[model samples]
Target: MTIAAAAPVMLCAWLPTAPGAATATAALAGVAALALALWQMLRRLGVPDPDRAAALILLLPSVALNGVIGAHDTLWAAILLLALVAALDRRHDAMLGWAGLAIGLNPQAGLTAPLFVALLINRRVPLLRWPIAPLAAAAALLGTGSVGWTIGLRPLLHEAITGHLLAIDAPNIWTIVQTLPLGYPLLGLAIAIAIGTIATVIAHFAARPIGDHDMIAAALLCTMLAAGLLPLMHERAFFLADILSLALALVRRDRAHWRIALLVQAGSTLALLGHASGIDALTILGGGMTIAATALLAGPLLRPAANDNPVIARSA
Candidate 1:
């Protein structure tokens, strides 16, 4: 999956510098990554050939969005997610391949999901191998002058890390509400959110009935929300949530939960559409909606099996 996925990125590395080179490179990379991901997913789930077409139908809108919007980061992020899922299903090679795709493109790409999977699988392997890819990629990009030192490596690295400061000059929606008094009320919000998060973690783990995949979905959702909530969150940071949300939808298998999961994707699309404010509205509104939707879709989990799946019944 990684070789096939990264092939386009590798090819783009050779494209003559042009006005749309980066965007074009990103587009090719996105398509390749999406194709590999879908193929791997179809294989892993053993979706019947007929159903496979339907699955691709659901996926096409997203794939098309990635290509058209040049959202390579999120596209690649989704690839990492599929890899992680593949690994969880015991497809370790695909996981490594997905991670390779990330390293070849962005160091921070799907970095968390693979590490999480490593912990779930063989912790030691992820600990040792994950960093190697990005580090080596960085060195190569610098050493081989794929990124020219003057206008490329140094500046790219500098901008990649420090550029956010220039891009984002204020607090995000969550911060705005939390810091209503202004002047970095972040301290209080940070402490409260931390406490709440820790408590949720404890509860989630202590409950123990929660499946490993469920826990992973929850963690991704938490991380996705945090990425957006943090000060100086650029539009790009939301890409971090791409896989986790999809994972949540697939693994949870509750229509309501799936709808909630869709919010992250929606938010991401809004960001690409230059609608950060809209994304903020959706996140805030969507959180409440997800809980209600979950209650309806997954009520059986909280009730007797006789509930007949409220969502499915309603739809019928």
Candidate 2:
């Protein structure tokens, strides 16, 4: 099984069954993973105890809501963070492996794979080592019985194409379009174009050899892009961006990162409330904050550091 999916399954196998036992167990596991990931990420970024504590405090709500109550997100978030930590340590193979396991858990996790590959290639890792990622992903999928010839590509394609075609309650440009009589397919196309354009620009500028900080920045950008651009995304998707941005903020000592993280947290919380209450207004406001935060974050994240040389930064 994909490690994310396997986690709960293994818990069930070993633990006694009771009302809410599974959820409680899953929540415990999620909380543990999140705490470890957060601690490791902070240490890697050289964050001081006070800053680390602040970051953790900022993430606590998300950990409770998404990580504990909504356990599906926990494993993927942990895997993603671990992958980022591996990347920061220059452990290319481990990064790729963790990323692959993430993708196997949730196809959406693949959104960051291209950026990871690009960064690795820019680092001049051997071409031969690159295939490890896709191979690991495939292996995880097969091991999980999530893919087979009879099952084929049809189910996967259908899920990808139709799963989140509508904005539903997500906060993004698509939510605005959903009310304007636009077709869902057309809206999807528009989002695709927008993401493509933004990604192209990021790729152009990100061609330089990247540093650990830059990789973290790239990950933050990718998470924001996915949360903003993807159709049918729920509030939980922002958890990744929120936590990653907090990490970046601690590393860079930039208030902008913290601001964006708070914006995302606020938006996500509102979206969840709206979803539970069936309140359109709350969802709308939440989405607006999310979009604004993403736009604000993109400006500083895309620019090169003013004092550092790209080559020197990369080699460091």
Which one is best on TM-score? 2
Q: Tell me, what's the RMSD of every candidate? A: 7.2, 4.9
lDDT of 2 by residue, 267-296 (tens): 877777786788978878888888888788
Which runs of model 2 end up more than 4 angstroms from their true locations? 1-19, 50-59, 67-69, 143-165, 182-185, 304-316
lDDT of 1: 0.47
- Pairs that collide, model 1: none
lDDT of 2 at 131: 81
The RMSD (Cα, Å) of candidate 1 is 7.2
In the range 95-204, model 1's lDDT, one tens digit per residue, is 66555555445544533442444243433344565554455445535542654323223433665467423223111355235424554535456546645644443343
Worst 10 residues of 1 by lDDT: 307-316
Clashes of 2: 1
